[model samples]
Target: MGEDHMERLIEGHKRFLAEVFPGRKSQFHLLAETQAPEWLFITCSDSRVLPDLILGTGPGDLFITRNAGNVVPLTSQDVDGCTATIEYAVEVLRVKHAILCGHSDCGAMKAALDRAGLDALPKARRWLQHVEAAFAHRQPVNSAEGESAELASLIRGNVVAQLWNLKAQPSVVRAVDEGRLTVHGWYYDILSGRIEEYDEELRKFVVLGE
Candidate 1:
C-alpha cells in the first residue's frame, strides 16, 4: 500500500511535468528566479486545509506555514519554527497580509479539550499548551453546529488567541505600526465551507463575505 501511494505521487509529478508545467513554464521560471508573495498564510497542519485550493492561490502567491493548532506562542523567549517563519515572512518577504487561519473539527483543539489521548504523545502534549488560552477567548457556540458546538467554539477561540500572539511578535509589531502589514484571524467551517473573520472592533467573528 505504501509503495502504491508513492507510485501515485510519482505519477502525479510526471503528469505535472508533462501536462501542467509546460503551460506554466514561464511562471515557474520567474518564480525560480525570485518570489515576492503578498500574503503570509499560517494555518493548521490538517490535510483538509489546503491553502492553495481553498484560496485559489498558486505558487509564488503565498508564503505559508502550518503546524498543529496553528499556534503562535506568546512567550517572547519561545523560539520555534512558527515564530521564525513569521519573522522571516514579515522582515524578509515583507508580506503585506498575514492570515492566521483555524478550522472546525481540528484534532489539536480536540486534544486540548480532552488530554487523555495525548499522554502517549509527549511532544504534542506540550505543544498544545499554547492553545490553552483558547478557553478564555472562546466564541459563542453556534447552535447550528449541534453537538460539535463546544469544539467549534474552542477552535475559533484558538484562532483569536494565536492571532493576538502573531501580532505581538516583535517584527509583526514594528511592521503593523509602520503600516507595512495587516494581520487577520479566520475560522473556516468545513461543513459549511464558509469562512469567518475576527473583527477587532466588534470583538466577534463575522462571515468573511459580510
Candidate 2:
C-alpha cells in the first residue's frame, strides 16, 4: 500500500516534468534565479487548504510558511520557525502583504478543543498551547455551520489571535509603520469553498470579494 502511494506520487512528478514543466519553463527558469513574491502567506499544514489553488497564485507569487495550526508565535527568548519565517519575509523579502489564514474543520483546532488524546503526542500538545488564546477571541457562532458552528468560531478566533502575533513581530511592526506592509486575517471554509477576511474596523469576518 505504501509503495502504491509512493508510485502515485512518482508518476505525478513525472507528469509534471513532462507535461507541466515545459509550458512554464521560462517562469521556472526565472524563479530558480530569484524570487520576489509580494505576499507572505502563513497558513496551516492541512492538505485541504491549498493556497495556490484557492488564490489562483503560482510560484513566485507568495512567500509561504506552514505549520499545523497556522500559528505566528509571539516574539520571545526562544525562536520558532513561524516567527523566523515572518521576520525574513518582512525584512529580507519585503513582502507587501502578510496573510494569516486558518481553515475550518482543522485537526489542530479539534485537538485543542479536546486535549484528551494529546498526552500521547507531547510535541503537538506543546505546540498547540499557542492556540489557547483562541478561546478568548472566539467569534460569534454561525448557525450556517450547523453542529460545527462552535468549532468554526474557534478557528476564526485563532486567525485573529495569530494575526495579532504576526503584527507584533519586530520586522512586521517596522514594515507596517513605514507604510510598506499590510497584514490580514482570514478564515477559509473548505465546505463552502469561500474565504472570509477579518475586518479590523468592523471587527468581523466578511466574505472575500463581497
Candidate 3:
C-alpha cells in the first residue's frame, strides 16, 4: 500500500518537472541565487500543518521551522535545530516577522496531557517540558467556544509559551529590540479552517485582521 503511495508521489514529481517546474523554471533559478524570505514561520511537524498551502505563500516568502508540537525551547544553553534555524532566520536572513503557530487537535498537546505516552521517549519527554510555560501564558478559556475548555486553554497556552520562547531567542531578541521584527502567536483551528491571533495588550485571541 505504501509502495502505491510512493508511485503516486513519483508520478506527481514527474508532473511537476514536466509542467509546473518548466513554467516556473526561471523563477526557481533566481530563487536559487538568493532567498529573501520575509517571514519566519514556526509550525508543527504534523503532515497537515502546511503553512505555505494554507497561507498562499511561496518558497521565497517564508523561512520555516517545523518540529513535533512546534515547540520553541528556552533555557539558552540547550541548543537544538529549531533554535539554530530561528537564529539564522532572524540574524542572517533578517525575516521581518516571526510567527509561532499552534493548532487544534494537536497530538503533541494531547501527549502532554497524557504524560504516560511520552515516558518511552526520554528526549521527547524532556523536550515537552518547554511547553509547560504555555499553561501560564494561555488566555482565559472561552466556554462558549466548542470543545473542552481545558484543552483549548492548554493549546492557547502553548501558543503563548512558544511565543515567549521565540522572543527569548538571542537573534529574535536583538532583532525585536532594534524594532526590525514583529512577533506573532496564532492558533489554527482545523475544524473551522480559521486562524486566530493572540493580542498581547488585549490578552485575548482575535480573528486575524484583513
- Please, what is the TM-score per model? 0.97, 0.97, 0.94
Please write out the lDDT profile of model 3 over residues 1-210, one tens digit for every residue: 599989999999999999899888888999998999999999988887779888999869989999988898888476799999999999888999999999888888888888999878998898788788877875676687676777888999899889988898888889999999999999998878789999999888999983
RMSD of 2: 1.1
Residue range with the least summed lDDT across 10 consecutive positions in model 1: 141-150
Query: Model 2 lDDT vs. the true structure?
Result: 0.92
Q: Given candidate 1, what's the lDDT at residue 130?
A: 94
Better of 2 and 3 by TM-score: 2
Off by over 4 Å in 2: none
Question: What are the lDDT scores of the predictions, listed in order?
Answer: 0.92, 0.92, 0.88
Candidate 2 global TM-score: 0.97
The full ranking of all candidates by TM-score, starting with the best, is 2, 1, 3
* Model 3 worst lDDT window (10 residues): 138-147
lDDT of 2 by residue, 1-210 (tens): 599989999999999999999999999999998999999999999999999999999989989999999988774469988898888999999999999999989999999999997999998998999999999989985787844877888999999999998888889999999999999999998988889999999999999879
* lDDT-superior candidate, 2 or 3: 2
Model 3, CA-based lDDT: 0.88
